[model samples]
Target: MEEKKAAALSAEETSAAPSLNNNTAIISSDEETQGWSTQATKRLLWRLDWHIIPFMSLIYLLCFLDRTNIGNARLDNLEQDLGLKGVQYNDCLAVLFPFYIAAEIPSNMMMKRVRPSVWLTFIMVCWSAAMIGQGFVRNYTQLMVTRALLGVFEGGLFPGVNYYITQWYCRHECGFRMALFFSAATLAGAFGGILARGIAEMSGVGGMAAWQWIFVLEGLLSILVSFTAYWFIFDYPGTARFLTEPERSEVQRRLKEDHGHLSNDFDLKYVFQAIKDWKIYIHMLICMAGFCPIYSFSLFLPTIIKNMGYTANNAQLMSVPPYVCACFFTIAASWFADRARQRAVFMLGFQLVGIAGFSMLVATANPSVQYAGTVLAAIGIYPQIPLGLAWNSGNIGGSLKRGTGIAMQVMGGNCGGIIASYVYLSRDGPRFITGHSILIGFVGMAFFLTSFMTIWCRRENARRDALTGSSGPQELTEEQKALERELADDVPWFRFTV
Candidate 1:
């Protein structure tokens, strides 16, 4: 009697299956079936980290150093040499982001078509050449041209890499990986100052100023690294050469199980779909709020320290400690965030910490206290970046939607860079009270937006759970499941990570 009922049920499921493909067999085997062990997973991740993280991090470090070294160059008379007056220096800083913003989405789309290694390396090379050209620029217009070109080339890297990393790691595992990759910028902050200080001694070499040497050296380093990246950087899982067939299959299976299904097919409609999703805008707002402070401080830290009465060399050295602190704190926070599997909670907590740091800056007169506040601000801001990025990337499923969503979020957020350039005016030096106050308000807004997102995601997850009758993937007929997989995160089986 039980056998008969089971047969009937199977027949009914087959009959009701949606017309997709005829392969209706369910894969009920566990990880053991694919020879996936804890040790194997560890070894695979280690291999990925070895190959992927360091290369990506190195690229970002160079990208950041080349982009922001102008702030260091300012101390070496770059502005005077270029005959920049009034808000011209600020305008140069501001101009980068408009082109940067405009290029990001299109660049990401191109990256998907051209492949990551080729696209990423191509951009790196272009930006490096632009960076080198800055050293030869004799006038403000020439400098602006180089800066604009640099922006266009560099804009795609961060979001493109962010999306690429998500393709390899599970949702829960991405936070720390992102932290490891992003910590390069903080490390760059620490090392770039020391590097800039040392390079300043090359003044009058090759008939160029110290600032010129700074750009030349860093740009050369970027170009060298780009050559290496061209040879070393792997494409997506399907094309990766290092993985065995079994290992590759296991990775694909595991990713699908960890998140929902993904599609590689390019569809412009995904961009519209992502745009209509209100959650994407919420995350973008949080990112924008966060970036305002991060870019403002990173681009101006040396100058800020100099304003505190340190010499240029001493100010460079002083800037190192805060970034060093931020590097360690960012890694630790990401590890904890990944372990706890709680992005929004951690993001809110860190944002509040940053707000406190800004408050200290605004409320204090003592240079020592303000410097301490800088450390706190670095600690708070750097960690939340990876958390927020991973949070949005992990929650958005499907390759096309994730790509477009990440690009949109990054593009929207980078508008803050423009705002940051203008807010920290030359006249606002010594205290920069207006800048600090504005940063505090942005951080506050970030906190509120993050809190709201947390609540909304939780509610959405609960609603999905109620509909599915379980908190996990629902059992559906094989054909129905096949159809659902193509729907990406829109499928009821998919749950948003809060």
Candidate 2:
């Protein structure tokens, strides 16, 4: 009887254990589900993946398209239209950068305080209007005005978008989304070139020049996109209304946890303090060095292809391949970056490739080889942008500080745009020997800086680890430690992945 009674009790205990575990699981899940209904979670994830991403990507696509359509216009007699000769075209290109650099910092600050959905959309609309106005330019003065207007509005786009992405996604999720948004630039290059070819073939559409069609169609499209952006795009997670109240709370909690409990506080003093930091200068140098070739390529790709003995249409179409390669590399690089949880190795590697490509271009004159260099250059140049943004932004501790830092980096980096415009003077157009050499040198410098920054970060992490006697190579205060845990749970929390 005792043996039989023991057997019966063991069976009951095994059966009851699962029931107890199930109840515990239910309670834990329920607690986490607080303020997050099933409906809300479903809607939020859906909107993020399906709607917001594509919408924003298209906006950036048009932005890049409008900015670069100038390349196509160059082939369509812009020089003749203005009666330009010997560096005037290049001078016009160079003029855009000063304004771009001057206005970039203020534009970012405005985005932070004025609300993104409103300001960003307004800027887009304004720039598109400027682009359309280009179609009406009968003299160099009118052209200059439109170009300046375009710069004034476009100055906000890239940096603003980078900041905007952070407000919605965690560090880990950021790479893919950043890649998607950044890839729009590549897509714009491809599509803009292709579109230019088709539109250029439509000579004298409504008695306007072929170049006018380029501006008119693209500008109108951009304006249309702005309306949609204004209607649908939210300022931040805190401002999104598409989600239920429960879902809204979940988003707020997630963002707070992921961001080290930092809130977005707009203070002019803090912005000034961020600007004063020396690291901001270093980042600026890195961006300027890295982006010189990119901006140069953006402006000169069609011209470069034309020199290879291709027809005007063929040259325009040829611009597509390099950018297509770049888009793939960008997405692949970002994926590997997020997966490996490292940024330095990929960044250094890509920049090194860019250096090599630009260096090779400087030595080669053969059409096929030069064409190959273009592919390598595009891939090398674009892959570094997102990695850089993530690496620096992730390290920042506060939203306000990060916004300021990003704004500064962007504003400072784009000095290259101005520099690049002047580098390849019209006299050196068909064979831009000096320009290629300078780009190679800058690319080499960028590689060195990225490598150096990576090593420094690793040493810092090691020192921190030793001080804390923690399991990892970095140490933090209790508050920082808790914040790290929260951030890590959302993402893998790998060290600066060099």
Candidate 3:
């Protein structure tokens, strides 16, 4: 019954909706895409998916692995060695987020100035070193310092890659690409466990503990990847070295068609303008709410599982399945979201799944049920991150606003990340009902906000459609159209994706 309903919805959407929605590139099903064919566009995307997504995916995978391995380290007796007691471990976790948040918008601004490849590679190198240094930390203070450094450097990659993906892909195309790129994060969760367990046997190796091996080995791998990834990361569509001149032109032209002449040039006005945009703030709020649970789950899943009566080694093994399940679900959801050409519909529905999951955790004292709840929660939480990211980028126009706004949204989310660190208290014990309940609230708030935005965007798009009054984009004067581009999301032809 659900499948049929979904199919009907898909059919209706395909028929009723314009391909060139608010955040989407200017194209139509019946119209020729400038001189470029739709098949050509798909081929180009295929080319880009091959070239761009892999390295970006790998980079994100490493970032997730480095940052969240602390959870795995706990299972390896890191707390005992470092003497992190009571809330001290939580404090160490929380310390990274402020620096992470602080670095984001500035890092994004610099990334645009220097180009993504250069900036992302530099951050990867710095964070890799920080991750390596984490393994060498003798005490909590040193751990805090290394974590802070890691935060500063690792902060850039997520927002950076998000902005970078927008440079290559169209708005409608972004959801899947972002999801595929983010699949690495789920892989990181799964692999972090596998790696953590595998390295556990080496606890006594070379005068280092298993946690140290996890940190050092993963960090060194990142360093190696950072050096090799630079050449593949590439610049914007206009300057891609792998593309032929025509391909580059087609790419840029397609981007220009979709978004009205997005300029990558660093501009103070655009940054300030993005700060002023209410929609950007709404994006920020949504992200802030969404990431609270996301960070909690990612940073503490291993520990959460360990508390479920599994040994640390068994917890590592068990943790892998939820993440593995989430990876597939995340990718599928994004693909379906893109196909439906709607955001809130899928998002709100899945958020309920997450809410239901967490409700189980809070309601149950049974470890098996609680573990099952975690799976549902993982299924619910992971997809929202990429979908929200793509939706945020899709709604915003132009490069400067995109960069600044995306980073700002992510920064807000990381603030939630900080709050997340303290949610699962030691006193909460096996159930951690407080933490689970908190997650339910935050994720529910995110759902409510997204629903509100859906209504707002739909109303705005209707107003714009009515204003255009059957006179298409071609009927508008060149100057008027250029002004629309300058206005970004406020223009008549540009309709926000609900």
| TM-score winner between candidates 1 and 2 | 1
lDDT value, candidate 3, whole model: 0.82
lDDT (tens digit, per residue) of candidate 2 on 37-149: 66866567666666567877888899888887888888998789778777767766766767766777777778665667777888888998998998888877778778888
Worst 10 residues of 2 by lDDT: 15-24
What's the C-alpha lDDT at position 300 in model 1? 89
Candidate 1 per-residue lDDT, tens place, 252-274, comes to 66565554334555678776778
Clash count in backbone of candidate 3: 3
In model 3, which regions exceed 4 Å deviation? Answer: 1-36, 261-264
Q: Scored by CA lDDT, what does every candidate get?
A: 0.81, 0.72, 0.82
Error of 1 at 374 (Å): 0.5
RMSD after Cα superposition, model 3 = 8.1
Q: TM-score for every candidate vs. truth? A: 0.92, 0.85, 0.92
Which scores better on lDDT, 1 or 3? 3
lDDT of 3 at 239: 56
lDDT, residue 5, candidate 1: 39
Off by over 4 Å in 1: 1-32, 471-473, 482-486
